[model samples]
Target: MKQSALSYFQYPEMVLVPLILFFVFFMLLLFFITRPKNRELFKKMEKMPLEEEETNNESIE
Candidate 1:
């Protein structure tokens, strides 16, 4: 019974440690990828012509 309890505790370190580490690593990766992409997209959006460009395109059509 004691050994079973010990194994139950040990199973998390053996299995869950790597799983947790992978989750953290992936979260960091997702943050880095999205942060820069979002900044770039926002910068581009800031310079975009609002209603003027659309009106010009409509007149040309």
Candidate 2:
């Protein structure tokens, strides 16, 4: 008799750890990226490509 792949995860704890870790990692990422303190930083990053030419022109003048 052959055991299906699901049989490997017969023990709940075996699957619980990875699920918990993934959830924690996702939440932390969401929190960090959306935090108020980092808002300005993200805004600047969003405009980087658009501002490149303006910055270059100022430097040349």
Candidate 3:
């Protein structure tokens, strides 16, 4: 049997990097399109613990 550079990508594992990158790029584009609300939602999600703490503190007061 013989192999060439083109045959390298025929190997499933070897093709994964580009496939993964493609989807990652797609997701980034989707994220950018939803920019402002995405950032606000991300910030809200990130502050969940702080909001939870505030609720706990208020209940204790």
Candidate 4:
């Protein structure tokens, strides 16, 4: 008898690959979130909304 390609993944072992990939991706996301960043850049971004057009022009000089 002939078997289809889908039959290969029916075994229980196929579950491990996806689980490991999910764990690795999750760990990478956590690592980036916990990592340190430039404080000055964040301060500039925070003040952007409050600054007016005149101050924006002066800063360009």
Candidate 5:
């Protein structure tokens, strides 16, 4: 039987490289989310629904 030519990415173990790349990107995303610079923005977004409800109640009064 003739042998087949496989490229670098065609190897099963080569899948690990992409997996590691995605993990690194995930860590970067977590870092950005937890950074202090965005803290106030996250807090305001967290309270957005409650604030909207308060305004709606006042208007309905």
Candidate 6:
């Protein structure tokens, strides 16, 4: 019983390290996204799809 109890966690099935790492990553991404310095980049990315479509249409037949 004693060994079983200790060994239960040896494999570490219920872990939270990954969750914390993911949360940290999400927060960092949010910080970068909200920063004013990145606004222009984001705006360009936002319009990229539309620009691509327009360019495709402008190609001669």
**Candidate topping lDDT:** 2
Task: Sort by TM-score, best first.
Answer: 6, 5, 2, 4, 1, 3
The C-alpha RMSD in Å for every predicted model, in order, reads 8.9, 7.6, 7.4, 8.3, 5.7, 5.1
Runs off by more than 4 Å, candidate 1: 1-12, 37-61
Ranking by lDDT: 2, 5, 6, 3, 1, 4
Q: What's model 4's lDDT at 34?
A: 64
> Which residue pairs overlap in candidate 1's backbone?
none
lDDT of 3 at 5: 68
lDDT of 1: 0.77
Error of 3 at 5 (Å): 14
Task: Write model 2 residue lDDT over 1-61, tens digit each, in one string.
Answer: 2468667656768789999999999999999998999999998999888874744445644
Candidate 5: which pairs clash?
none
Structural RMSD, model 1: 8.9
* Model 2 misplaced regions, further than 4 Å: 1-12, 54-61
Per-candidate TM equals: 0.40, 0.55, 0.38, 0.46, 0.58, 0.58
- Write the residue-wise lDDT of candidate 6 on 1-61 in tens digits: 8888888557464467888888999999999889999889988998886774533457566
Measured with C-alpha atoms, the lDDT of residue 26 in candidate 5 is: 99
Q: What is the lDDT of candidate 6?
A: 0.80
Q: Judge candidate 5 at residue 58 and give its lDDT.
A: 57
Candidate 3 regions exceeding 4 Å error are: 1-10, 36-61
lDDT tens per residue, model 3, 1-61: 3656667556678689899999999999998868886787787788887774533345644
Candidate 2 is scored at a TM of 0.55
**lDDT of every predicted structure (CA atoms):** 0.77, 0.83, 0.78, 0.76, 0.82, 0.80
